[model samples]
Target: MSGLLGNHFITQIGILVNDIEKTSKAYSEFFGVPQPEAFLTDTLDKAQTEYNGEPSVARAKLAFFDMGSLQLELIEPDEHPSTWRNYLNEHGEGPHHIAFVIEGMKEKIELLDRKGFSLQQKGEYEGGRYAYIDTFKDLKVLVELLENDKK
Candidate 1:
């Protein structure tokens, strides 16, 4: 079911937690994955540049743990309205979504639309584009597409 969707690389998995440092430490100490590189909301000038040429304007604590070619971005928002916080506040956390690596995002979105999938939201990240879809909602899950791998 994943082959035609392009290479389903597990580029990232978001684990929305109430505490980032504690979670990072647990992963680093137990699984040997490097504790996430902390990013502050104030230092997202570059992120701002990539996201919208002005940033998404956020304040949160984040860390990344590397596992093979994939990374897990652990986020803890200091405020409300963020999807991560909303997820925990509403649904509790587990595996938020599996990000697939794709090239032509808009086209893929169109394709999904033709396939009867609905878009939840779409955004630009530090190195790629991402969109959340409702295909798996019946199964209580989300399918995410991320454009990365430019080097």
Candidate 2:
């Protein structure tokens, strides 16, 4: 296994919300930051999505707040069987996951697999790929792995 953890950096904090617009406004007001524009995941290309290791077309409304080096992400899940939706259904709306940006995604995924973390969900965007690892039982939060395209 590769030194995935050593090479990774926590870059984002993700939250699951029942309503994206309200949550975004709340967060913006609380943090004194401007409310971010919401984006729909289904509108993006290269959106290869999955839930619980099965192919899925789950979509979500997403908003992001830039907090210097880290970002705060708010996700409002549609009526779909996605990780976000499941979290919202089972645990209500709250902090869901923390994301790490890394270089070698496949190697890092293999390392996490060897360490017994199951991949709960995955998706690919135009120039990046992301995976959610089921670490809530141990860490009280899911872990997201992000790999951006190399320029």
Candidate 3:
């Protein structure tokens, strides 16, 4: 599994939270940093989100904090069948996924699929796209792949 993902550099950690406002505040107070603004995920037209191989309107409130070399992400999912919502329903609030910034999104997804790691949910953001792979059964945590547009 050494080269499963070209490199092992984790760029972000995502956590599912029932209350983004409260959680963000608590994290800010504890870390002595300002609470980051929370915003909803992009709409279907822009995000092109998919869940379980079907088009989905699942959205979430998100807040991000830059902590040293890694980013801490807080997610509060809407009442939709997304990876975020599913995990929260089954496991309550906790860590959801660890993400890596990678290139060759299509090839990486194909490689993971061949390795039995199915895609759970995927969507697009302003500058990039993200995919959540079903690696919990093996790795005990979901794996997210982020591929940003090259500038």
Among all candidates shown, the one with the greatest TM-score = 3
The better-scoring model by lDDT among 2 and 3 is: 3
Model 2 residue 72 lDDT? 90
TM-score, model 1 to reference: 0.72
- The models' CA-based lDDT, in order, is 0.66, 0.86, 0.95
Off by over 4 Å in 1: 1-4, 41-60
Cα displacement (angstroms), candidate 3, residue 30, comes to 0.4
Candidate 3 segments whose C-alpha is farther than 4 A from its true place: none
Error of 3 at 48 (Å): 0.2
What's the true lDDT of residue 104 in model 3?
A: 87
How many residue pairs clash per model? Answer: 2, 0, 0
Model 3 clash pairs? none
Lowest lDDT block of 10, candidate 1: 46-55
lDDT tens digits, residues 7-107, model 3? 79999999999999999999999999989999999999999999999999999999999999999999999998999999999999999999998888889
lDDT digits (tens) for residues 75-131 of candidate 2:
999998989999999999889999988777778778888888888998897789999
